[model samples]
Target: MIRKTDLFSGVIILLGIAFYYWILGSYFPGKKIVLSALIILNGIGLMVHIKYFDSYKKGTYVTFMGYLATLGFVLITTALELLEIFK
Candidate 1:
Protein backbone atom coordinates (compact mmCIF):
# COMPACT_ATOMS: atom_id res chain seq x y z
CA MET A 1 0.00 0.00 0.00
CA ILE A 2 2.54 2.54 -1.02
CA ARG A 3 0.43 5.58 -1.51
CA LYS A 4 1.67 8.20 -3.92
CA THR A 5 1.26 10.92 -1.32
CA ASP A 6 3.66 9.22 1.01
CA LEU A 7 6.18 8.66 -1.77
CA PHE A 8 5.84 12.21 -2.97
CA SER A 9 6.38 13.50 0.50
CA GLY A 10 9.62 11.60 0.65
CA VAL A 11 10.70 13.03 -2.70
CA ILE A 12 9.83 16.54 -1.61
CA ILE A 13 11.83 16.10 1.54
CA LEU A 14 14.86 15.05 -0.47
CA LEU A 15 14.33 17.90 -2.88
CA GLY A 16 14.29 20.27 0.04
CA ILE A 17 17.70 19.03 1.10
CA ALA A 18 19.04 19.30 -2.43
CA PHE A 19 17.79 22.86 -2.67
CA TYR A 20 19.33 23.68 0.66
CA TYR A 21 22.74 22.48 -0.40
CA TRP A 22 22.46 23.96 -3.87
CA ILE A 23 21.64 27.34 -2.44
CA LEU A 24 24.57 27.24 -0.03
CA GLY A 25 27.04 25.35 -2.21
CA SER A 26 29.27 24.56 0.74
CA TYR A 27 31.00 21.30 1.53
CA PHE A 28 31.03 19.81 4.99
CA PRO A 29 34.34 18.42 6.08
CA GLY A 30 34.01 15.57 8.54
CA LYS A 31 31.35 15.03 11.19
CA LYS A 32 29.22 17.88 9.99
CA ILE A 33 28.16 15.87 6.98
CA VAL A 34 26.46 13.38 9.26
CA LEU A 35 24.01 16.02 10.32
CA SER A 36 22.93 16.58 6.74
CA ALA A 37 22.67 12.87 6.05
CA LEU A 38 20.47 12.18 9.01
CA ILE A 39 17.65 13.97 7.28
CA ILE A 40 17.92 11.74 4.26
CA LEU A 41 17.78 8.68 6.45
CA ASN A 42 14.83 10.12 8.25
CA GLY A 43 13.00 10.71 4.97
CA ILE A 44 13.78 7.20 3.79
CA GLY A 45 12.59 5.81 7.05
CA LEU A 46 9.38 7.72 6.61
CA MET A 47 8.82 6.27 3.20
CA VAL A 48 9.70 2.74 4.22
CA HIS A 49 7.37 2.64 7.15
CA ILE A 50 4.49 3.99 5.16
CA LYS A 51 5.00 1.55 2.33
CA TYR A 52 5.91 -1.58 4.25
CA PHE A 53 3.90 -1.40 7.40
CA ASP A 54 0.54 -3.08 7.15
CA SER A 55 -1.15 -0.81 9.69
CA TYR A 56 1.19 1.86 10.87
CA LYS A 57 -1.05 4.31 12.56
CA LYS A 58 1.37 7.05 13.52
CA GLY A 59 4.52 6.21 11.67
CA THR A 60 3.87 8.65 8.88
CA TYR A 61 3.34 11.73 11.00
CA VAL A 62 6.04 10.90 13.48
CA THR A 63 8.68 10.20 10.85
CA PHE A 64 7.80 13.20 8.76
CA MET A 65 7.96 15.42 11.83
CA GLY A 66 11.34 13.99 12.69
CA TYR A 67 12.59 14.77 9.18
CA LEU A 68 11.30 18.33 9.33
CA ALA A 69 12.79 18.97 12.75
CA THR A 70 16.14 17.63 11.62
CA LEU A 71 16.00 19.64 8.45
CA GLY A 72 15.72 22.74 10.61
CA PHE A 73 18.77 21.62 12.51
CA VAL A 74 20.67 21.04 9.27
CA LEU A 75 19.80 24.50 8.04
CA ILE A 76 20.94 26.09 11.24
CA THR A 77 24.16 24.11 11.28
CA THR A 78 24.89 24.97 7.67
CA ALA A 79 24.25 28.63 8.30
CA LEU A 80 26.49 28.59 11.32
CA GLU A 81 29.18 26.82 9.40
CA LEU A 82 28.96 29.36 6.61
CA LEU A 83 29.19 32.16 9.13
CA GLU A 84 32.20 30.52 10.79
CA ILE A 85 30.45 30.89 14.10
CA PHE A 86 32.25 28.25 16.16
CA LYS A 87 35.12 27.18 13.97
Candidate 2:
Protein backbone atom coordinates (compact mmCIF):
# COMPACT_ATOMS: atom_id res chain seq x y z
CA MET A 1 0.00 0.00 0.00
CA ILE A 2 1.22 3.46 -0.89
CA ARG A 3 0.90 6.26 1.63
CA LYS A 4 0.17 9.91 1.01
CA THR A 5 3.59 10.79 2.30
CA ASP A 6 5.22 8.64 -0.34
CA LEU A 7 3.25 10.27 -3.12
CA PHE A 8 4.08 13.71 -1.80
CA SER A 9 7.74 12.86 -1.56
CA GLY A 10 7.85 11.58 -5.11
CA VAL A 11 6.11 14.61 -6.52
CA ILE A 12 8.32 16.94 -4.56
CA ILE A 13 11.44 15.26 -5.87
CA LEU A 14 10.34 15.70 -9.50
CA LEU A 15 9.09 19.24 -9.01
CA GLY A 16 12.41 20.13 -7.48
CA ILE A 17 14.22 18.90 -10.56
CA ALA A 18 11.92 20.82 -12.88
CA PHE A 19 12.36 23.92 -10.77
CA TYR A 20 16.10 23.55 -10.78
CA TYR A 21 16.17 23.32 -14.55
CA TRP A 22 13.77 26.20 -14.87
CA ILE A 23 16.05 28.38 -12.78
CA LEU A 24 19.11 27.37 -14.75
CA GLY A 25 18.25 26.92 -18.36
CA SER A 26 21.69 26.31 -19.74
CA TYR A 27 21.97 24.64 -23.11
CA PHE A 28 23.43 21.22 -23.71
CA PRO A 29 24.89 19.56 -26.79
CA GLY A 30 25.07 16.09 -28.34
CA LYS A 31 25.39 13.30 -25.80
CA LYS A 32 24.75 15.56 -22.85
CA ILE A 33 21.40 16.56 -24.29
CA VAL A 34 20.44 12.95 -24.74
CA LEU A 35 21.49 12.13 -21.21
CA SER A 36 19.48 15.03 -19.83
CA ALA A 37 16.47 13.88 -21.78
CA LEU A 38 16.88 10.41 -20.37
CA ILE A 39 16.90 11.79 -16.85
CA ILE A 40 13.78 13.79 -17.51
CA LEU A 41 12.06 10.75 -19.00
CA ASN A 42 12.99 8.76 -15.92
CA GLY A 43 11.32 11.37 -13.74
CA ILE A 44 8.17 11.18 -15.85
CA GLY A 45 8.14 7.42 -15.46
CA LEU A 46 8.48 7.84 -11.70
CA MET A 47 5.49 10.14 -11.66
CA VAL A 48 3.48 7.42 -13.39
CA HIS A 49 4.61 4.99 -10.74
CA ILE A 50 3.59 7.40 -8.03
CA LYS A 51 0.19 7.81 -9.60
CA TYR A 52 -0.57 4.11 -9.73
CA PHE A 53 1.54 2.90 -6.87
CA ASP A 54 -1.25 1.35 -4.88
CA SER A 55 -2.41 -0.82 -7.76
CA TYR A 56 0.51 -3.20 -7.50
CA LYS A 57 0.61 -5.77 -4.71
CA LYS A 58 4.39 -5.42 -4.28
CA GLY A 59 4.86 -1.79 -5.13
CA THR A 60 6.58 -0.53 -2.02
CA TYR A 61 9.97 -2.13 -2.37
CA VAL A 62 9.93 -1.92 -6.16
CA THR A 63 9.02 1.73 -6.12
CA PHE A 64 11.65 2.63 -3.56
CA MET A 65 14.30 0.70 -5.42
CA GLY A 66 13.37 2.35 -8.68
CA TYR A 67 13.67 5.75 -7.04
CA LEU A 68 17.07 4.95 -5.62
CA ALA A 69 18.31 3.42 -8.82
CA THR A 70 17.25 6.43 -10.85
CA LEU A 71 18.90 8.74 -8.35
CA GLY A 72 22.13 6.80 -8.56
CA PHE A 73 22.04 6.77 -12.35
CA VAL A 74 21.44 10.50 -12.58
CA LEU A 75 24.19 11.20 -10.11
CA ILE A 76 26.64 9.09 -12.04
CA THR A 77 25.68 10.57 -15.37
CA THR A 78 25.87 14.09 -14.02
CA ALA A 79 29.32 13.43 -12.67
CA LEU A 80 30.43 11.98 -15.94
CA GLU A 81 29.03 14.93 -17.81
CA LEU A 82 30.74 17.40 -15.49
CA LEU A 83 34.03 15.59 -15.87
CA GLU A 84 33.61 15.41 -19.64
CA ILE A 85 34.02 11.66 -19.49
CA PHE A 86 31.84 11.08 -22.52
CA LYS A 87 33.83 13.47 -24.64
Candidate 3:
Protein backbone atom coordinates (compact mmCIF):
# COMPACT_ATOMS: atom_id res chain seq x y z
CA MET A 1 0.00 0.00 0.00
CA ILE A 2 1.94 3.00 -1.26
CA ARG A 3 0.66 6.52 -0.96
CA LYS A 4 0.96 9.01 -3.80
CA THR A 5 3.35 11.21 -1.86
CA ASP A 6 5.62 8.27 -1.13
CA LEU A 7 5.53 7.24 -4.76
CA PHE A 8 6.49 10.75 -5.77
CA SER A 9 9.43 10.69 -3.41
CA GLY A 10 10.60 7.42 -4.93
CA VAL A 11 10.32 8.85 -8.40
CA ILE A 12 12.36 11.87 -7.43
CA ILE A 13 15.09 9.67 -5.99
CA LEU A 14 15.17 7.44 -9.08
CA LEU A 15 15.38 10.41 -11.41
CA GLY A 16 18.09 11.95 -9.32
CA ILE A 17 20.23 8.85 -9.56
CA ALA A 18 19.64 8.44 -13.27
CA PHE A 19 20.43 12.07 -13.91
CA TYR A 20 23.55 11.80 -11.80
CA TYR A 21 25.06 9.11 -13.98
CA TRP A 22 23.74 10.37 -17.29
CA ILE A 23 24.07 14.12 -16.85
CA LEU A 24 27.19 14.12 -14.77
CA GLY A 25 29.05 11.36 -16.51
CA SER A 26 29.25 12.72 -20.02
CA TYR A 27 29.82 16.20 -21.47
CA PHE A 28 26.40 17.58 -20.80
CA PRO A 29 26.14 21.33 -21.30
CA GLY A 30 23.87 21.87 -18.28
CA LYS A 31 26.02 19.90 -15.87
CA LYS A 32 26.06 22.65 -13.27
CA ILE A 33 22.29 22.88 -13.22
CA VAL A 34 21.96 19.13 -13.07
CA LEU A 35 24.37 18.85 -10.17
CA SER A 36 22.67 21.58 -8.19
CA ALA A 37 19.27 20.12 -8.95
CA LEU A 38 20.26 16.63 -7.87
CA ILE A 39 21.50 17.95 -4.57
CA ILE A 40 18.41 20.04 -3.93
CA LEU A 41 15.93 17.48 -5.19
CA ASN A 42 17.43 14.72 -3.08
CA GLY A 43 17.20 16.93 -0.04
CA ILE A 44 13.66 17.83 -0.96
CA GLY A 45 12.81 14.12 -1.21
CA LEU A 46 14.20 13.55 2.27
CA MET A 47 12.26 16.54 3.54
CA VAL A 48 9.09 15.22 1.98
CA HIS A 49 9.64 11.84 3.57
CA ILE A 50 10.07 13.50 6.93
CA LYS A 51 6.97 15.62 6.64
CA TYR A 52 4.51 13.30 4.90
CA PHE A 53 4.75 10.03 6.82
CA ASP A 54 5.62 8.27 10.05
CA SER A 55 6.29 9.45 13.58
CA TYR A 56 9.46 11.35 14.42
CA LYS A 57 12.05 9.08 15.88
CA LYS A 58 14.86 10.23 18.11
CA GLY A 59 17.99 11.56 16.32
CA THR A 60 16.19 13.12 13.37
CA TYR A 61 15.36 16.43 15.00
CA VAL A 62 18.68 18.09 14.23
CA THR A 63 18.73 16.80 10.68
CA PHE A 64 15.20 17.96 10.04
CA MET A 65 15.72 21.42 11.52
CA GLY A 66 19.02 21.84 9.76
CA TYR A 67 17.46 21.00 6.43
CA LEU A 68 14.67 23.51 7.09
CA ALA A 69 17.09 26.24 8.17
CA THR A 70 19.26 25.63 5.14
CA LEU A 71 16.25 25.78 2.88
CA GLY A 72 15.15 29.06 4.43
CA PHE A 73 18.60 30.55 4.03
CA VAL A 74 18.75 29.48 0.41
CA LEU A 75 15.37 30.99 -0.32
CA ILE A 76 16.15 34.29 1.39
CA THR A 77 19.55 34.60 -0.21
CA THR A 78 18.16 33.72 -3.60
CA ALA A 79 15.47 36.33 -3.24
CA LEU A 80 17.95 38.98 -2.18
CA GLU A 81 20.32 38.09 -5.00
CA LEU A 82 17.52 38.31 -7.51
CA LEU A 83 16.80 41.84 -6.25
CA GLU A 84 20.49 42.68 -6.50
CA ILE A 85 20.73 43.33 -2.80
CA PHE A 86 22.87 40.47 -1.55
CA LYS A 87 25.79 40.71 -3.85
Candidate 4:
Protein backbone atom coordinates (compact mmCIF):
# COMPACT_ATOMS: atom_id res chain seq x y z
CA MET A 1 0.00 0.00 0.00
CA ILE A 2 1.16 3.51 -0.76
CA ARG A 3 1.81 5.79 2.15
CA LYS A 4 0.06 9.13 2.43
CA THR A 5 3.32 10.96 3.02
CA ASP A 6 4.64 9.65 -0.28
CA LEU A 7 1.56 10.98 -2.00
CA PHE A 8 1.94 14.31 -0.29
CA SER A 9 5.54 14.65 -1.42
CA GLY A 10 4.53 13.93 -4.98
CA VAL A 11 1.87 16.60 -4.79
CA ILE A 12 4.36 19.10 -3.44
CA ILE A 13 6.73 18.35 -6.31
CA LEU A 14 3.91 18.82 -8.80
CA LEU A 15 2.95 22.08 -7.12
CA GLY A 16 6.49 23.41 -7.48
CA ILE A 17 6.42 22.63 -11.17
CA ALA A 18 2.98 24.13 -11.62
CA PHE A 19 4.03 27.24 -9.77
CA TYR A 20 7.06 27.57 -12.03
CA TYR A 21 4.90 27.34 -15.13
CA TRP A 22 2.34 29.70 -13.70
CA ILE A 23 4.98 32.34 -13.14
CA LEU A 24 6.44 31.78 -16.56
CA GLY A 25 3.20 31.76 -18.53
CA SER A 26 1.51 34.94 -17.40
CA TYR A 27 2.02 38.47 -16.22
CA PHE A 28 1.13 38.11 -12.58
CA PRO A 29 -0.10 41.27 -10.96
CA GLY A 30 1.70 41.76 -7.65
CA LYS A 31 4.20 39.11 -8.58
CA LYS A 32 6.41 39.86 -5.64
CA ILE A 33 3.74 39.20 -3.05
CA VAL A 34 2.58 36.04 -4.80
CA LEU A 35 6.04 34.62 -5.22
CA SER A 36 7.05 35.53 -1.71
CA ALA A 37 4.03 33.76 -0.27
CA LEU A 38 4.72 30.75 -2.50
CA ILE A 39 8.29 30.57 -1.29
CA ILE A 40 7.11 30.60 2.29
CA LEU A 41 4.51 27.94 1.58
CA ASN A 42 7.08 25.68 -0.04
CA GLY A 43 9.39 26.11 2.94
CA ILE A 44 6.61 25.22 5.34
CA GLY A 45 5.62 22.17 3.30
CA LEU A 46 9.21 20.93 3.29
CA MET A 47 9.47 21.37 7.03
CA VAL A 48 6.27 19.46 7.58
CA HIS A 49 7.50 16.62 5.38
CA ILE A 50 10.73 16.44 7.30
CA LYS A 51 8.98 16.47 10.65
CA TYR A 52 6.51 13.78 9.81
CA PHE A 53 8.23 11.43 7.38
CA ASP A 54 11.76 11.61 8.79
CA SER A 55 13.37 9.81 5.88
CA TYR A 56 16.86 10.48 4.54
CA LYS A 57 16.50 8.79 1.22
CA LYS A 58 18.75 9.89 -1.61
CA GLY A 59 15.98 10.49 -4.11
CA THR A 60 14.03 12.60 -1.68
CA TYR A 61 17.11 14.68 -0.91
CA VAL A 62 17.79 15.31 -4.59
CA THR A 63 14.19 16.27 -5.30
CA PHE A 64 14.07 18.69 -2.37
CA MET A 65 17.43 20.16 -3.41
CA GLY A 66 16.12 20.84 -6.90
CA TYR A 67 13.07 22.52 -5.43
CA LEU A 68 15.31 24.67 -3.22
CA ALA A 69 17.38 25.74 -6.22
CA THR A 70 14.25 26.90 -8.02
CA LEU A 71 13.09 28.75 -4.94
CA GLY A 72 16.51 30.37 -4.56
CA PHE A 73 16.40 31.74 -8.09
CA VAL A 74 12.95 33.13 -7.56
CA LEU A 75 14.07 34.75 -4.32
CA ILE A 76 17.10 36.42 -5.92
CA THR A 77 14.99 37.72 -8.76
CA THR A 78 12.40 39.01 -6.34
CA ALA A 79 15.05 40.80 -4.31
CA LEU A 80 16.37 42.51 -7.40
CA GLU A 81 12.89 43.66 -8.30
CA LEU A 82 12.43 45.04 -4.81
CA LEU A 83 15.67 46.97 -5.13
CA GLU A 84 14.55 48.42 -8.41
CA ILE A 85 11.27 49.48 -6.86
CA PHE A 86 13.01 51.23 -3.99
CA LYS A 87 15.55 52.92 -6.25
| Top of the candidates by lDDT | 4
Clashing pairs in 3: none
Report lDDT (CA) for all predictions. 0.52, 0.53, 0.52, 0.56
* Model 3 lDDT tens row, 12-85: 64664465456533664665565566556656666765674343233378645644554454444333323332
- CA displacement after TM-score superposition, residue 22 of candidate 2 (Å): 28
How many collisions per candidate?
0, 0, 0, 0
Ranking 2 against 4 by lDDT, winner: 4
Q: Kindly report which residue stretches of model 2 are placed more than 4 angstroms away from their true locations once superposed.
A: 1-29, 58-87
lDDT of 2 by residue, 1-87 (tens): 666645655654564465346423444455466555555655655575556545543656776676666555545544543444244
Give the per-residue lDDT of model 4 (tens digit) for 6-53: 565566556556665676445657866766665665566656555754
True-vs-predicted CA distance for residue 1, candidate 4, Å: 2.8
C-alpha root-mean-square deviation, candidate 4:
5.7
Identify the runs in model 4 with alpha carbons over 4 angstroms from their true place: 53-87
By the TM-score metric, which is better: model 2 or model 4? 4
TM-score, structure 4 vs. true: 0.47
TM agreement with the true structure for every prediction? 0.32, 0.36, 0.49, 0.47
* TM-score for predicted model 1 compared with the true structure: 0.32
lDDT score, candidate 1, position 61 = 81
- Per-residue lDDT of model 1, residues 1-87, tens digit only: 766555655565575566456534555564345544544554565565456444444467885675465446445544544443234
Query: Lowest summed lDDT over 10 consecutive residues: which window, candidate 3?
Result: 78-87
- Distance (Å) between predicted and true CA of 68, model 4? 12
